[model samples]
Target: MFMCRGDVDSQLCHECIGNATQHLSSECSLSKQASIWYNECTVRYSNDSFFSVVDMMPGFYMCNTANFSNTKSFTPLLFSTMNLTADEAASDKKKFATNERVFEFQTLYCLAQCTSDLSSKVCGTCLRSAIKQLQIHCDGKLGGRFLYPSCNVRYELYPFYRSINVPSPNELAPQTKDSISKQDSRFLEDPFYLSYNCSSNHNTITSKNFNLLLSYLVSNATAGKLYHRVIMDEIVYGLFMCRGDLPSRLCVQCVTNAKDRIFSMCLSSSEGIIWYSHCLLRYSSQYFFPNIAETSPMYRDINITNHFISDQNLFTSTLSNQLSELANATGNSDERYMINSLKLNDIQTLYTLEQCTPYLSPQECISCLNDMISTQIPWSFLGSVGGRIIYPNCNMRFELFQFYIESDEARSSRNPSKEAGELFAQIGFILFL
Candidate 1:
């Protein structure tokens, strides 16, 4: 059996497999049974078939060669993480697992993997054997890996695994305790507003009234209504919605940026919508909250890199199937959002994302998505490689690459202030039209 380390990146896994095969053939040429382990992969060959069988012999243990001075706390946490990781790998469909645990001084990352051919019970037994071997041979080491013909486990202070490649709105800004506090304050104390019937009294509604309404809306967000509304002074109706995936900190920054930009740009319009990468801020004199229909304005952005080929029925059909499935899934979910994917070949894949404001019922969500698929989306877009269509209540998007990170994946920040400012400037210029 041959297996790659579960935590290794794809590129390294391939390279390590090649190296392991070549070395194992040369080093163990006389033996009837041979196995080799590399940093990223393992290879084994035997005269007899070893499928579905647990083998503990010919095991190897390698440690970091450096001893940890802080073994008292580190040993307990390391062993605990190893046991938990073993359980996770045994239960998961992949028979592989990675975990990170934080300590007072640093974080520990661990991975456990068994050959896919093993049964869950057999895999669990193999990992337990490997863990015991690791403890006996490398208990006080800074890092170590125990390798057997059927399973392997490793731990390190630094991250080693390649995480799923999904982009998220939270990437625009890092979450910090101070940033979370600042975001909460910004939403309550400052809000954008427009008066429809009272041009004369537009200036009459004091800043206090706007703050009070915005404070209510902000509170709604804390309660998990990312899309929420409030009425101010019995006149101004305001609504704000954060992207469902955005963290609280980025949500706040995005909304604050929208509010500041909209207020400065559209000073007295009776209706307006400010769109950001992670959120939307809108205010209107007319009631638009809980909009169940698909009549709200829509936004579209398309990728122009590739067009459909002449003989691409398989590709087109696969794309449509995935998108339709995502639409159905999103409509049926409590969050009203879902992601789906389809593989066209070894090299090409399509990913789709669809979402609706949670206020909409399942039927309303379905209707809203159907309207976009039929009317708003152009036929030519279906031939393109990627595109996004965003709406107030519902939005649908498809691309050739994965775009959304799962909720549990690790998150990192990318600065978005400059781009957001530029977008606000463009929207401001368009407001006059």
Candidate 2:
């Protein structure tokens, strides 16, 4: 068996593969055949013949078992998403792809993979077979996975693969210079807007929010920020956030550029959010809190074990309680999440994190958090815990392990100007008292 990182970039693939080869041999000493998979790559070697030729003998097919309401519509959408993703993977040297398609407002996440060694035709064939196997096993279910010797495909209601790099839709769509200028003019005229009436005179902006938004924007806008512009309207407000790890100037530039791009795309819509692994973009005409909305659309790669938790009830209760506490504590605070580990038994630990946006009221945060926990706890998420609840004003996410950067580093990297703004607000409040 062989397992490689789903997000391995072309430059680092060979290095990861080499590391996996060495590690697998040492870790599985008694077993002549073993496979180790990473988020960035995979490696496996078996004493038995398991290369070049596709092997379906020891494969598994699992699905949600609940059939789609409209098979005809779902089937075509599924096929299209698969085809698009395959074309992308085939063209790219990494041998991986991630894509999402919508059916009746439901998002379907699909990931396809072929061994780096396979020819395009062979890769296509292997993926097709793997997909067919999923249909046989999962039938009408909302999610399924098919794994074979040479290739694999997985489809789920939520994203599974992490950090797939693909060209944006705007890149593929043709636009003349005149059209581009017109679009830019329209975007600048009426950009996304949000209204946050200051509840108190002492209320001030925090560097944390600016930092989060800036880092998120930079990661998405790798080209540069000078080409982009920020547009604020009366009815709707737009804020683009990049990953927190980026350089300060780069983060600002990324956010600026993304705001321009987002304005161009969503100028007509009243509410929308588009997020990349590195940045998050949000715009809303109405206050959207304590209300369920899918504004910020983002994806991450997650590798769940095939094994199920030994004690389902205990795990569920523990996770739920932790989430509730986090929600209550994170209200209107820059540090909105917490991650820690608990020893389950001698060999296993339940590592978890609970996070919410800093803008939400405590009650609003808890309600939103509970809704997310309810959806994920009931599902058999490959023995892994993962879920994301997107709202207009705030969002909440939790997993069994640490998937995001720690809060300390995130806080330290805030904009100095924004930090001063927060400090000023605090001082004003003390003076008022």
Candidate 3:
């Protein structure tokens, strides 16, 4: 059996299913019952009669361990959003619904689904069970996923899905940080795990030579010249929009600096990604955009202390408000913004950075930033001193301490100043965010 969200892109859907099938077939060949999950789809095979029946057996729940700032308000809001999305999904023919709702200033993204074969009631029950299970397993998590045999529920702070109803540029604006974070909760670390049809082109390599050439350039070029040269070579075409926000010289320098570190850390794999405090570099022959490929490698620092707060809800809620304000302010401006705030415990501070590709309209930039913020909040490592969201088109990050250098002149700040009005508009006609 296979299940997937209806809203996912066709190519991504197929790729996800294909991976699940191949993995399950090989990994569980002898077992009578087994299931495999990818970032985009899910596949299962069982000897017990489960084709039409809603089986909640073998359920799984995964959640971020971080606590929220305000438990009372956050829990109710979270439950309500999940319940609403699940109902919509159960009633819909495709068994999928992507929803964004507001709680205080925070916006939450949620996805709920069931196998197409199951009845609405069964799906609802399965989702409820999954939610209940998450309470025990995930508790005060920033994000969590509950998977059942017939149904599933995912809630997060970011937009994990590419909606079928793509918003027009005018309608796209930076949403509340809470909303973004909630949406991110639903995004699977691997989008291919959901249910969808697989195709022959699922994992086709699109540009092997180009990626190889870019890797070679990254390896040979000095840190200062590497970024511009890569862009000139068209290897970083997607990143071109960020040029206006970054100084031409500094942009090249940053890319070069990042390349040196990334090459040393990630090596020159044709299909790997290397992330730095300032930038991210991914060179994959496999096309990752539009189709929702989730194979990008992830790394988390384990050195940060994982101290749990006594009041999880308070921490999360407060953080959500702060993030929402930053997102809105940054989204409204042409330039990017960074803000750092101390938590209730003076020992720790929440750091945030928001940026849009120079090409994007303010609204588009906001929307993209909102999506990144939502997803990162959920998957962020517990007790993480730092976290980041690096999309092909846009990027954002936050850390406990200042990892980026800020120029004393203030005019040459690492992140563009919010006070700089319409910086992108003055640069070019094309919107890059």
Candidate with maximal lDDT: 1
* Candidate 1 lDDT by residue in tens digits, 1-433: 6787664456556666676666666667777777766555677888888999998876777565446677998899999999999999998888999877766434566889999999999999999999999999988876677888899998865444444332321222111232122232222323322111212224334455555555665566666666777776658787777755556665666566666665655455555676655567766566776646544566665432244222212333334434544565566667776655554445655556677877788768766775565345433223344656667778776665555553443222211211101111000000000
TM-score for candidate 2, residues paired by index: 0.37
Off by over 4 Å in 3: 167-433
Please give the range of 10 consecutive residues that has the lowest summed lDDT in model 3: 424-433
Q: Write the per-residue lDDT of candidate 2 for residues 1-433, one digit (tens) a residue.
A: 4446465445445655665666655567677655554333545566777666655444555454345678877887887787787777666576778887656644677888888777777777778777777767776666666665566787765444433333321122111232112222221222222211112222122333323433444454555431222333333334554443344465555455555565555444555565432345664554443333232333322233455323223343334444443444443344444444444344444444444454455445544544444333332332334444444333444443344444455545432212210111110000000
Q: Please report how far candidate 2 places residue 40 from its true position, in Å.
A: 5.4
Q: What is the lDDT of candidate 3?
A: 0.51
What is candidate 2's CA lDDT for residue 209?
37
Per-candidate Cα lDDT values, in order, are 0.61, 0.48, 0.51
TM-score of each: 0.44, 0.37, 0.44
lDDT of 3 by residue, 271-322 (tens): 4454443444544443444423132233322222344322123334334444
Error of 3 at 157 (Å): 0.6
How far residue 429's Cα lies from its native spot in candidate 1, in Å, is 52
Which ten-residue region of model 2 has the weakest summed lDDT? 424-433
Query: What does the lDDT read for residue 149 in candidate 3?
Result: 65
